[model samples]
Target chain A: MAISGGAKGILIFAALALLALALAGFITGAIGAAFVDKFSGDENVVHGWTGDVLPLDQPAVHLAPQYVFGDHAGDSLDYDNKEAKKYDDSSKIFNDNSFVITNTILSSLVTSGVLIFLFVLGTARMSVVPGRLQGLLESLVEGLLGFIESVMGAGKGRGVFPLIATIFLFVAFNAWLALIPIYQSFGVIEDGHLKATFLRPAGTDLNMPLALALISFFFVEILGIRAHGIGYFGEFFRFGNLLRGRILTGLIDVFVGLLEGISHLVRVVSFTFRLFGNMTAGEILLLVSSFLVAFLFSVPFYGLELLVGLIQAVIFAGLTVVFAAIAVAPHEAEEH
Target chain B: MADLGFHWPSLLVFLVNFGILLAVLYYFGYKRILAMLDQRSASIRDSLSEADRVRQESTQAREELEAQLGEARRAGQQVLEEARQAAERYREEEQARARAEAEDFLRRARTQIEQERNQAIEQVREHFADLAITAAERVIDRSLDRDAHRDLIERALSESAEAQRN
Candidate 1:
């Protein structure tokens, strides 16, 4: 709590410097310049160069990741220009093209590499008495396994842990990595504005979340079928009572079964959009904050995005565990 | 859906990427670490049980050693007590034998002294009678019958012996 005179002076000086930088960033940024042009009555002074220099172009939100390399990188540039034109006129139709190496794909590869490298380093010289990195890795694994076991029960939990933990870590790391300043800084620049970056968060891409959703969907259905045999489908198609001459109750059961079947399929769409929407919204929020104030303002949003990433990851993995548990449980045990 | 970037190829790629990651992480990270943990715990349990066994064995051995030492000490005391009693009995028997021999020698010495004193008294009586007869004869200047003197001395000695006997 106590600071020396010299240290106190240095601290005060640092705070003042940061305040000055934030104020300067605001004045030259998009909102502050619009006010300056309006009040100072000088259109030529600040507005001319600031518009060209500050990347003041509205953020282009394409649901797909732009290609940064490979054969489709040239087509990706054309597609970027088309997307940019749509923001100005609102009548242009967007062209969709499949590319070999998109920025999001690159980001996912980087995330995977980092995870593997960390694991290799932690487990290279493992012993009963662990060093710091080994200890950290061990505790992370144990904590994740403990949480999962608490949800799914101990014996069944370990059976599904690898898949659950991988999904959680991958999604969480992808979001966190995008929060780094360099991810948005350098990119393929066209027409004095940014087009595509070398990296983007994998979660932002529609395909990434779609892939995860499909994986989760299949895993859940397969587990159910394996657990209950053909009877798992009986939960969705209940015509058995109608065959036995209970007309009223059979109709109700049949209708409820129909609803259940639709809802089970709807899970895929819900899972996909939930992650993609959150990730895309976060990315856009960061872009808009920087466009509005340019500096010191997006820092808080970065913290918000960090919490969002963790929550989304936990939700994704936790839901999967719950679904798996439901799948494996005896559905008709209570009826008996 | 196309506007949302739903390409089949890209989704397939993502699936493959995830599959590879899962395989590597499961094999390299989770399996080995769990195995090592189980091994460490098992070894620790074995060591603890081994230590308990050694402590019990040492305690039992110490008790046995103490019991043996007590038994030896009691045996030694019993031998020493018997030796002491035997020595006391030998000393009493030797004392009794030495006292009986000394009493027997004292009785034999008393009988020999009585016989020597009686003999000396008889010799002294014979010499005294001879001297008296010689002196009477010298005064009378006549020869006295030797046989008569002798007879007279013998008769007097016989009567003295009879009186001493009575």
Candidate 2:
């Protein structure tokens, strides 16, 4: 009976993989024809994969001035151009960045929602011998915990594991899910152009990265404050206690402290750009690859992006854990 | 990257999304799952340690039982040996006492037999003397008394007893 359990485990895994493969094939079959039929147009309609390029701002339809007075195709084309121009002018007058929600924000919401759903379902019934969802989540949790413990001591790792792991899963899922042939390929046709893609990978957005950076930045600083009280400020503005000490040594200490503070502050920018740039570049690379060499050659690049996506998540989470450890460690504590 | 420039609305949306994610994940899933994992691992470890301790205790008890069995065997042998030795000593003492009593009885019987034999011989010698007297008296028609023969027999008996003593 015990031996049967082992065999059953293998059989289950193989069956699940086969089922997934079959589902993917079925989806590609259903959607591939429609995509080809729609996009297989003349060369003028540039199959912009990234959708970053705005195709030539051409008229949606023919219009004429006479069309306003009488219903006619020629007259409509003449009048439509003026109407379009007037709409553009008014839009320009009131347009502000405040209301301009990027595709990344929507992607981010989708990413978070998916993660929450999976996590909730996975952990709903946690048997000691886990089910499928629990098994997957356990592996992820254990792996992140191991990484955290390896960087920080086991005691300190527990404190920051949740935050780092959350960031990692959110970022990584967005990156990989963004590549699943859905984010950019499908969108509503607007004004004779495929504008306003409904989904974008969260990491592709600068704002998402900035938000993540701010989160990490605040966490690190908070940890420092908790660990050392007001003394953590010494790492930054060391000159506060300056002239009341050893003169030459104090000046060097203050200057070094200032440099350290600057470096610490710059980490927010570094974090933001690093993750945002990597994920965005990865998407662009995949899009370009797909365009250059249809499906066959594109497969390898997809695989490459998968690896890259994983690496980015690991780097992001790993750095967060390490930084938290460094921030929380007391100055007098010897380095492990 | 047409809209790659800064967007204030995007920032707020991202922050809001992240905030919701943090709350949902921490409250609904991660907290419980992590606690369960910790509890399970600790339970497993405790069970393993308990099993090890039980094994150790059983092994120790078995060894003690073996040692006690060996001691019991040795003590049993010692008791058996003591019993055999006591039986042997009792048999030897009984045999020696029996032999001494038998020798004393034999000596007393010999003394009584010698005295009886001497007495019988004296009676036979007196009877023979009386028979001779009677035969002579019958032939000559006279009676004779042989009491002097008894004295002779008594003297011989005393000498024989002194010889036996020497």
What lDDT does each candidate get?
0.78, 0.69
> Per-residue error at B54 for model 1, in Å?
4.5
- Model 2, which residues run further than 4 Å from truth? A1-43, A46-101, A191-193, A240-242, A245-254, A332-336, B1-3, B63-86, B93-166
Model 2 lDDT per residue over A186-297, tens place: 5445447554355667776677888889898899999989988998887777675467777887887789888888888899999988988888777677655554333544
Error of 2 at A272 (Å): 1.0
What is the clash count for each candidate, in the order shown?
0, 11
**Candidate 2 local accuracy as lDDT?**
0.69
In model 2 chain A, which range of ten residues has the least summed lDDT? Answer: A61-70
Q: How well does candidate 1 reproduce the true complex, by DockQ? A: 0.27
Where's the lowest-lDDT run of ten residues in candidate 2 chain B?
B1-10
TM-score of each: 0.74, 0.68
Q: Write the per-residue lDDT of candidate 1 for residues A226-324, one digit (tens) a residue.
A: 989999999899999988999999999899889888987898899999999999999999987986787898889999999999999998888888888
Q: List the residue pairs that clash in candidate 1.
A: none
